[model samples]
Target: MRWPRHVASLLLTAVLLVGPPILLVRLVGWPSIDSPQVALWQWVRDPLTEQNLILLLVGLAWLLWAFVAYFVTAATATRVWAGVRWLRRLPLPTPWQATATGMAGAAALTIATPTAPTPDASHPGTTTTTGTDHDIVEQADTADGVALSGGWLPYEVAEQVTAAAGLVWLRRRRAYRPTRPHRHSQDAQDLAPLPSTVAAIQAATGSRPPPPVSAPAAGLPPIGFPPTGVGLTGPGALDAARGLLITALLATLRQNTVELVITRRAVDILLGPAAPHLRPGAGLRIVDTAAHATALPADARPSLSHGAEGGRRVLILDEPPRSSLANSGATMVVLTAWPHATTWYVEAGGHTRTSDTANAGPRVCVLDTVATTDLLTVTGHLQPPAPDTPTQPQPQPQVRVPRPTAPHHDTIRPDKRVLVRVLGEPALLVDGAALTVRRTAARQALVFLAVHPDGVDSHLMAEALWPGLPGQRLTGRLYTTLSELRTAARTAGLPIIDRTGDRYRLHPDHVDVDLWYFHRAVDRAAAILADPSTAWQAVVDAYAGDLAAGHAWAWLDPHRESTRRHVLYAYAALAAAAPDPRQALAYLQDGIRVDPYNADLHHRAASILTSLGEHIAAADLTDRYTRRLATAGLTAEGALIRGGT
Candidate 1:
């Protein structure tokens, strides 16, 4: 229940501000007044006396202090209660806010109480004084005034009252000072302007001006603006230019294309669906370090190294090389993402050179994507070069030798196949070595296929993998995941999964799946029911644990439970066919261990124990089973065993 705001404010005022002064006055043996109102009236009527005058001043001061304290406390209480209501909706404990408020109140009380002074050797008699000199002076002055006025209250008492009141007032003011909230202007200037194509090129290449365009000759049409096609505005213009530049560079490099050294991540990004198609036949070399690039075979084709190169050959760096290309005997050094707009670095005469103009040399071309595209388009229209004259063949001496018969080789040894285990924790073993398949979707696909040997169609696979995704998105993700799985399989020297139409499957001959073996053992045991001991034991041994025990997929639960039921059946068959009672009891116990809640297995074990003359043990087992069933909110299916079975 909550009280009215005025009532709560009045209560708080009486307890905190008015009560403290009243208690202090009482402590000094001041006349005990039952009613605060009567005390105030008595003080007003008898103001001539110093005692009454002091009381009247203290009461009026307290009334003023209470009024201010009441409003401040009421405002703070409203805010705190609102916060409490908000906190209650969260997951926090119920009493936390109250506990926090209590702690804060205690802290305020501690700060309000002045620390008593420690004894000093110079002044041995004044050990109980407060530490502050102002407090001591105030107390001394109050005591002297009370004595001079011949007041009813003792000097020490008056001094104590004044000190307590001053401390309380100071503490209250310090704890609650109202201030206006700060406001922010909506028109604040931005610290930095947005980046633009011109700004980016200038920053990269330095403050050089753009190359001047040559005027067209007389009777020739001026190079009017190339068709302003779609995706040629704003930042997209830079992207389109970059794309064309890359295409031109690749085309030029194809003339003598040798080795292409790039980072794996960069290769993936550049070769993604959105990037331009790269011409085939370039020696695609991926390296994780610059050191690897330096050690590449020199006999390989002309190289475009992402960083520095060691050989004295034409090196096209995608970005500026860390070391200067000067005196390196490089035929050409093309730097992309140049630091300046008008200037670029080049290599010529076995030294690195800087050019501020576009017509510096045939070996240098520092142009953006659009410029590169325009140059390539113009060059493509030129006529073919004249054919070179062929040289006449010269005669040379030759020796005749007998040719030796060579042995013919036909079949090659196959690579070690992949073995996937999903009976327990999912694992992929290639050639007896564990292969870490990091992608979660790829792993899930493998596990799903392992359980369903006769592959699942793409539609069903999609539903299982991404349950709530849209159809188009689901199809795309499924294809990407399947591609990743096939790549991983091939890289590990395992047979790639084959897809017949929309159905994807791993060949049984190449992939030995553990789930298949478990099901095979169970099938064999069912076929040989006459003497099923060996077959059933094989079934038990093949099942290491539940299917995909560690992976959490909703679809996996059904497969896990199905596999578990098969194991339970095998255990039950072995127990019923055992010749000895003890052996049968052991089999039943094993079945119970696999599934503790199987009341049938528990009953069989108990019956075996009773047959062996262990009546007490059998009864205890039955009691335990009964308790388990009750705990699971299940009624016992059979009568509970007493002393005898």
Candidate 2:
């Protein structure tokens, strides 16, 4: 019952062109034959009169012409329509260009019709005598000859073809026209500039912009800790607290230390983030309520323990133990959300508790979001302690003895062995002997002076080291610390600490600090911009650790973070210019170690590994980094990594 549109169209065309002739033949009483060949022959032989036969033949020819024209028009229209759609998608110089192009395409497809031949000069509208059949036949033959002659096409058709071709040429010329680059000065002139104050205000109020995607090396991970503690009582502090707590737990476990654990959602919050970073053989064991009731150790309360080779086993609890003395015998008990003002508590018996104010034996520490982050950063460098093995007895401590004063006029060269290291703990080695300053304030003063070779006035030093203390008391403390430092320096036979009135600075000639060497390397690398491989290597090597690691002095963070940024930039430049993927990966790895929390570095490393056909390695690296981010409650960023993968 149903037919394709093309098939139906063809049938309708055939019926319109061929139906009338068949009807006329039937009406004229032409004899019918079953066989088509016989019917055709019979019709040809007895189709009645010549006039009828001629009419039939002309109708057939016209039908054939109509069929040919129909197909040709359909084909041409299809091509022109396709071209119009294609042209519409392109960026045209003007809106009217598409219309003009469509018109041109339509015109190009138009077929020109032939013009009638010119009138004959000799027989123009002539009256024919032609009463005879011979004359009439000759006149008919002459008319036929005139009709057969081919003539030139119509003028309009020629014009349309020319116009279509010309339009196409113009369109092509416009499409491929070259454009000139704008001058920098001209570009600057076009843009309106804002006042410095207004710009600064706008920048401060605006949302932080996304990091640029110029290169994989542009973004670096956060290294070390912030100077000020990220407060735990904020809206989003809960997740951060959980992340930090888990990080601390993992750090302790890595050190093969045992501790008591108590938490409800330990599996979801702790194990999830720590899973990827855990070394092989580490395990987490849950202590059920029944086990706690029946299997509690006799001499020692249930305690967190490590498997052989320092594999971690966490004992997650559904609730705090009912017995107050439940974990009294535990080696190290960590109580979460315990109420305390000045001291931590360890459970002993139903009403017996011990305060660990001095942080002695089996220490118990309260957990919170801010505290967790602080502890993780402080204990980041702790490694698993090796198995204990007994040997010889310890030697007695030696008494400090001051060296004889050097002559004032004597030529005293700067001791090359004098080195001040502040990357981790502040340490000073004079003549290859490490000097130990016991007081925390004195140590801090020494570090402050070491960092600022230009020397700091007493007021500024007091302000930085002791922010809220009275001026007189601060002066007393500063003098006392300086005296301690001088005594140590004198014992080492070095004129390391020098004072000029109120200003105190390390004698630069008598000591060389690690930070100074790091800066020098960076400067040298910058100076030799042409070939900086060796100098850059020095820069990387000299940065042994973050500036004043584990110390979060208010004034020290900015300088520390600034140095880290410079080191990252140097590494980024090196990676970008590396000749091969291997060299680039090496540079990137060094950067990653310095700033392991940086997602961009991990993404870049994964991309390079993917390009090198290391699919498994790339997946592993991406997975591990994403897990780390998840631990830190950065699921949005983790999703970005997954999407990229």
Candidate 3:
């Protein structure tokens, strides 16, 4: 019942071809293979031409042949009709079988029969030509024109010959060249020659060097943003938004560190034209977020409008002000919803309700690509707390700052240490130990280096992490933090090599950053797959652990996607490169599990199953893939309805 459409189509076609012949035999009688001569003679002879005894035998033979053919046709036709009906229940090319059959027949005819040239007016005795008029005339010959082809030619041939001759006749008889009208030299010369003498002053002026050119004024920028009020305007905003969203979706490349997301609709709208350039291996994770059918906010209906631009950064869409909608939390809400992997949280009546309860972490920032303009209005300037703002200490707290009793070197040790600080705080982990970081200035200094990783400039670092601190004071703080961090590392038996001119780098072997591990695995897999023989072992070992457990930082999604993609790629390569079908299927199955949404993966799995003669499994996988796609909101482009059936 769940037979593939192709299989059903084949059965239907076989029935159509075999049924007609059998039915004709049953209704009119066909010659039997066993008694060929008698059957043939009886079939050809007129109904009235036989004796009574012969007629009775012929009638009996005819009846028998009719029964045989009828039974065969009826049985096959009934089975095939049912198959075709079943095929029509799916959303696929159900009737394409008929078209395919027609095409096949046409192709067979074309290949089987050799083409012959059409009869020429001059020659009048060849076959059909698939050439043009000029060619026909050029190739025709009076010598080849023998008796007018047994009888009259088909009407088409006659017309072709007549048309060719007419075209040739027209070519020979046509001519429309323009005549040159005579011009009087006396009248023409006097009117045109206003003199070489007048060129005297012009020559003197032309001999002088041209004045130095001045730079032209810059013109106004083009109407850069999309007129639809989508935040697609700016110098590179459109390009940036696309890259950002794509990167976010495909965070596997970035290990999911970048926080950006887009809706399926957004992907479709932006990527439809550029679909050809979309690389499947680029480690993009574009998930369908169209499942949310929730209504818009109560007070803020999303009205598309533009905002003022901030240099080359902002994309403003100009629109008439909606006074009622102004100042509502529309902008933040919209931007947050713009991304697929997004959820919201609200605190009301002393309780917090979160939309993303399934997600393990709390939400930090929301990026709304919708008509929400709140973010566009937020000025990035950080103003100091008001002068009269009194910072209140916790009511129950009376604390003294803990002073280090041990030497600076001993106090900075790392051992089974857990260092917690703000994102930019300086917390060091040496081996398996953690170092106590001086809160604030010293902690931030360490974090700046960790985040930058490539080594920040000492001057720039001083200015940025400790903005208002004076030169000597800030440098002293930086040194103190560096000392404590180094001491902690040494105590924990870790490596921290200081470089000349105030530079530092973490030892690659000692520090196991997740980002580094992800890249190593991906790179190794890619390398081996490229050569197959070179880095095979490394590739396998690298992808052993996922973005280290419990470390699904929002920023690491891209990296996660990247790592997952490489794993799949490695598996696929292994499958393809393997000589054994069993091994190939194993690898393909693993890849499928990791990247279930990949169409090519499904195709590969199905192919491997089919190759292994697991037809049922192959069919089932295909059905599963089709259903999965339908669930993702992609409707079939065509209906699979059997035409004749």
Candidate 4:
């Protein structure tokens, strides 16, 4: 398939060259040749005949036709080959392309975006997103970072979260497809991955990870060099530079893969307010120096010789470096082309010419300031508190709660119950039958409601669902999720959700939550009631696990951690109440397993062991707890010598 055009061109040329000669031969056989020993005198005797003249004309015509055929075929083949090569060289779009662009990003390009469809009130069916939805939005198993959501997260934001999800997928890849840095000497006019391999894999696997669409003019490879100098200049220099910066930061989705070293002023110019939240953090360092406006960080002595090869520290600047960063072992990317050696000379329409090849590179990715700012908000960047945030009160039960049309609208009630479980892996069961929530947003909405029992106001819900995303941009998605949830409630004969004005809350009468049970038990244990130990036991029994234990919903951290502490408290209370030393030790051990870094649980267990004449066991528990806490970035109260010894 790759050379079909080549093959066809070859055939056409062959016919053109042979066709005329064959016709000439058929009409009058091939001309006979003789020695030209007496050529001038011999020509006079043979040339004047009618037969000789016809033969001369035919032979002359064949020679002219063959000459024309050769040049025509050569020209056509050269152009076709160039087109084919360029197509094969095209790269796949970066993962966060659409998400980063955002609704505001539409201004970056002139092409009109299709009108967003109105939210339909029909089926809660499986919706398709251009393969970006394939990312799993749970937290890392180590329980380190927040679980990121998909759907409406800004591209820059998605780049990090989605990249994290992609990282997990990559680690699970059956084969390693190493991405080599494109060398300056070569155009990287590389062929696409073989169709045979992809087709075979596609046939064998189901679409949990969607298949990559291979097109020749799809995307441009991110400009990543190994701690070296590159320049971007042309009409699109600024926009192209923005794209590179975004990509470099996104590479951190692999965690410590790339470190972007930038000056505070450069950050202010490039990112503005977003500069603070995304900086002074992992994989990005903001340097403070009064040396020069374009100087590297004062303390940044990056290793180029013997350091992390896969992990790169890319230092981007407004002007070319006076000192070679390569000697110091870090990448230096400049905003101007022809800074000495022309690396990339891009045009206004995005056509780029690179030093690597004479051919023009594909349309390189670009980002305007607005798009860059928008994406930076979500990606490795944190959200600063909004200036004009509304202080809307939580939805109160006394207010009028309007339900969507149900089995009987007048008789609408939580008369039938649906059990929503979020204490562990979230699940919904209506009338004892499991109801599968298909859309990720809808399920997340359900979990969001379960956590905020008092209900979330419209703006809060929108911002929480897709942080920093404009409500107008997410109107369809929000509507779709809420509409489907409403439809599900109606179908199940339960008033699961109640909305008044712009506030949405789960119906207290109809929907039962396991978290409610956990909270109640916790409240009872904390109360001044008699036999609080029994209440503590109830608390421990009620907590199946942390809230939405597996998924890394970014918003779930506080609630999850808070709930976990209550469980630890409950366990400690139960252990204290136990009459037997062995029973108390058992309680402590169970609590330790639940929260390994809980110093109190470990100490209590250790104390019990020591009193029972097991000093070695106490020491071992202390050592283990110390290490666990240190690993999780916590300070262990009793384990001081852990660092040195």
Tens digits of per-residue lDDT for model 4, 1-645 = 869998997888788887887887887877665655654455678877786577568768977997887789798799999999999998856758766767446665766655863221111111223233522322211111111211111122223434333222222221111121111111211111111111111211211332222222322223333235667777776765665676666665444456676766666666555555444565566665322423544335343224655555677666666654433445666776534544777665445677566766544445555556544533435444444534211111121111221122212134446878888888887877777777777777888888777777867776566543335766666777888777766657767888988898888768777776666555545654577787778878888887887765544444555566667777777788799999999987888776665555666688788888888777787777666644533345434322212
Order the numbered candidates by lDDT, best leading. Answer: 4, 1, 2, 3
Q: What TM-score does structure 2 among the candidates reach? A: 0.36
Which window of ten consecutive residues has the lowest lDDT sum in model 1? 222-231
Q: Can you tell me which runs of candidate 1 are displaced by over 4 Å?
A: 1-416, 626-644
- Which order, best to worst by TM-score? 4, 2, 1, 3
Query: lDDT of each prediction vs. the true structure?
Result: 0.47, 0.46, 0.37, 0.55
Indicate which candidate wins on lDDT. Answer: 4
In terms of TM-score, the best-performing candidate is 4
Question: Can you write out model 2's per-residue Cα lDDT over 402-439, one digit (the tens) per residue?
Answer: 11122221112354557778876678777767988776
Q: Give the runs in model 4 whose Cα sits over 4 Å from its true position.
A: 1-223, 233-260, 271-308, 311-313, 323-328, 343-416, 436-440, 466-470, 473-480, 486-494, 529-531, 575-585, 596-645
How many residue pairs clash (N, CA or C atoms closer than 3 angstroms) in each of the candidate models, in the order given? 11, 4, 43, 7
- Model 1 lDDT, residue 547, Cα: 81
lDDT per residue (tens digit) for residues 1-645 in model 1: 456987986787567766766776776544456798986777678758887766666667667766777787898899999999998877753598889988999899888555863332221112242223210111121111111111111122223223322222222222221111111111111111111221122121111212222332232111111111011122222332333233233333333232334443333333332122222233334555433444455555544333234222223333333444331332222224334222333331111123443443111112333322222221221121223313211111121111111111111113426778888888877777777776677888888877666776999887665542346667877787777777777756656576789987776556767777676566556667478788888978888887887654534534565566667777887888899889988887887777666656777788888878999888888788678655543445544333254
Root-mean-square deviation of every model: 39.0, 41.6, 40.2, 24.6
- Kindly list the per-residue Cα lDDT of model 3 for residues 1-645, writing each as its tens digit: 657986987787666556756766676565334576775676567545555345466567657656766776798799999999998876654578878978998889887564743333222122342332210111111212111211111122222223322222222111111111121111111112111111111121222222222222122111111112222222222323432332222222212222222344544444443322232222222334422211222222112123223111111111212232233222212222222222233221111123445332211111222201111111111122333445311111121111111122211234323232222222455444556654434444544444334455676566544332346655665666567666656665555533557765443334433333334444444434256623433444445444322321212222233345455666766777788888878877776665555556666677777767788888787777667655543322232211111
C-alpha lDDT of candidate 2 relative to the true structure: 0.46
RMSD to the native, candidate 2? 41.6
